[model samples]
Target: MSPIPVELAVDAASAVAANGSPRKTFFGHPRGLSTLFMTEMWERFSFYGMRALLVLYLVAPHDKGGLGLNAATGAAIYSVYNAMVYLLALPGGWISDRLWGARKTVLVGGVIIMTGHFLLAVPASVSFFVGLGFIAVGSGLLKANISTMVGHLYPDKNDPRRDGGFTIFYMGINLGAFAAPLVIGTVGQSSLGYHFGFALAGVGMALGLTNYVLGSRNLSAKSSVVSSPMSRAERTSMLRKGLFWLALAVAFFGAVALAGHLTVGWVTWTLTVVGLIIPVIVFARIRRDKDLSTDERGKLTGYIWFFVAAAIFWMIYDQSGSTLSLFAQNNTSSKLFGFNFPSTWFQSLNPLYIMALAPVMAWLWVALHRRDKNPSTAVKFGIGLALIGLSFGVMMLAMAAASGGVLVTPLWLALVYLVQTVGELTLSPVGLSVTTKLAPKKYASQMMGIWFLAVTAGDCVAAVLQQVMGDAFLSTTSFAIQGAAALLAGVAMVLYRRKVRALMGDVH
Candidate 1:
């Protein structure tokens, strides 16, 4: 019932009622969570729906209405697009902190996202890339901010309900992801065509937008806009500068594209360089701030490991959409129980696994805390890394089984996803919680964006790896190397867990 921590900087009115009585509830949490939960569910529907189709569409033959790109080219495009979706979160956080509030930014993002999905339905070459660009930008705006808004619903930092609440929120994301492939994949791979599937994704986004608008009254009004908004002139200046840089980038790329020399390879390379440099610059700037105390600086340094670990985790996990998707199409058997399913449905396993595991894991976190037995964040991360690494080992075994151009059983891939999902449960939500805990007060709002930069880093490196190695990216040696890196990272985190704990001070 007290004010939220200053480091979070969320207004207290967000969770406190004017009347101060019993409030409406969704499954024993705040009613507002339902709004956020449903909104995110539909947004993910749009995102994963399109995601399930992107690589397949690119690799499909020209006669089948695809772009007819090679596996390498398709993977490159997928990786780059994924990179941009996360990379822009840095600026997206800036925009929300200074101009739009979390609520407004999410709304604007939804509109843009809907537009992008519809554009993707056009079935034109120009529209496809353009649509992806729009969705990336919109998603960047919406992603971190919406998560921040969810924090607003929980005013008490020590409330035991916090982790469980987030688990429910996370489930909303999984719900959308679980359903998208079945619905969109079936439609796209059917007689109706891919563009129709894209359109349906847009329809899902539109539904989400409608739900959000209608439920706005349930959200906190005080937190609907930026707390300290920029002045008109400052806002104008910032916009102008952003536009100038953007125009320069567009012009440069447009000229190259017109000359037919700007390929997916070029875009991915640029993203790789930018992604690698961003974390360095941001980390240095934050670390050097004079306002920080000795303990704060120590914590920031510890965060570097977390950042690197997250990058490694995502690099392998996200390949489900690209490298693994291609494998499903080319190498995995689709027939199960005498019924053939689309390869795209394999992507759904992640969310399905998450759905099944989230509740038990969520309850375990709270119970462990209550019993004073919860593992330190670093240890949890160690478990996560180990699991993801093991998933790769499973992949290597599957590769061996399919050595002579044989189609491996779907069970092999399912096992990989299952192991990886458990790893994700250990690390992903814990990462979000720890990022908010360790972040500096002055830059409270922007911390989520900094967190997302880890994803950008992973995706960029992944794209670059695929680009440089080309077809060799599929080799068992590649999986072995990546898996070993993760396993080693896990061991290092555990061996040095005491140091990280010291760096965290009282937070963990």
Candidate 2:
């Protein structure tokens, strides 16, 4: 791709840096915010854009420019792919803290991600899996580090603007997500073919990289510095160990391939099992740490509860890309005002709702805070879980309405997304903020990695659930079961809120 014009980049930078010093302020916050916001917007644009096409491309007939895979296999691959994206963060965050630092890690990740998209633009199975692998590794590096830098932008943990900054940063994420399906999905799935969509995603990543490069000067010194540097001898020893592990992984996968056992099912199950196990081990280790004070141990216990809530919420929410997308295509009405909408467009609803409601929710939190009536984090988490359950409850009703082999109105799916978006606002940002706040200083980066492991575990569970649920995904019975499970979890959280709050100490 051609480089973004330097003149335009200069002009944009100047516009964002109207004050004397470019580092001083932009839109009443750090000028670095502009760079981070735009960078993440484009990164998400690429990520979601490609995701919108993933399952569709997998299940589409080869004659129609698709891979012709079964729905179960496609969903399995998708779940594993997403799980790896989050799972690798454990090592990615470590590398950032101990070696590359956030800035270099993000830059390397962006390049890898761009390459992944371009590889996906190739119409071959090998390229497809390779591309997925690259994107997963790249995203693992970029996601947590960028958010870490956002926190770094505000040194004062008590800064009232911190939450607002994250909220605004989150808006960037949604904005990219909102645009991807409408633009990339529409064009890529149309006469242009799926490869075109992949290409567009690549272009988005390229732009993100460009933005990051041009605005690097505006970033705080903290963004570039390694938080926990190691000696050269230590680094060399670590590198040798990493290489040994990498070779072992390659050998194992090569053996699986040679044995003709390297199918999607195998990959999916392996990742699922690993994803589930890692968090358990991590939590056990943390709980056993002899250095932790009683207060710290209590906070860690409270964090586990929050972690459980987050994992459950994500398992349900992430269905939007798998079973839910299939429902939109096969079960929901596509017509509105006499025009048939692309099923992929339904994927846009969550981000659209998020973009519209995030600001309102942010303001509401602040407004309630002023009155000393803001809900505690635990309560908000309960509310979020309940809202997600309600979203599925809407799905159950929609399934019932379509019981007779008829397509239900698309509005039902839209309503589900709308409710889920509200739930997301309640849980996601709060989760990110609290993870940073609650982490022990020495293990800060690893704690962030652990937070993502919850997401990985959720995706793993989702994969297994997708396989087991299968076509039941289209039935009212399945919806009812899932919805009820979420509601029960939410109610349980509420009942335990007082205990959790006590453990949380003064953090809330």
Q: Whose lDDT is greatest here?
A: 1
Model 1 over residues 97-135: C-alpha lDDT tens digits? 788888999999999999999999997878988899999
Model 1: residues with Cα > 4 Å off, grouped in runs: 1-31, 153-167, 258-260, 363-373
Against the hidden true structure, what lDDT does model 1 obtain?
0.85
TM-score of candidate 1 on Cα atoms, chains taken together: 0.90
Each prediction's Cα RMSD?
A: 4.5, 5.0
lDDT of each: 0.85, 0.84
Residue-wise lDDT of candidate 2 within 73-115, one digit each (tens)?
7876787788899998888888888888999999999999999
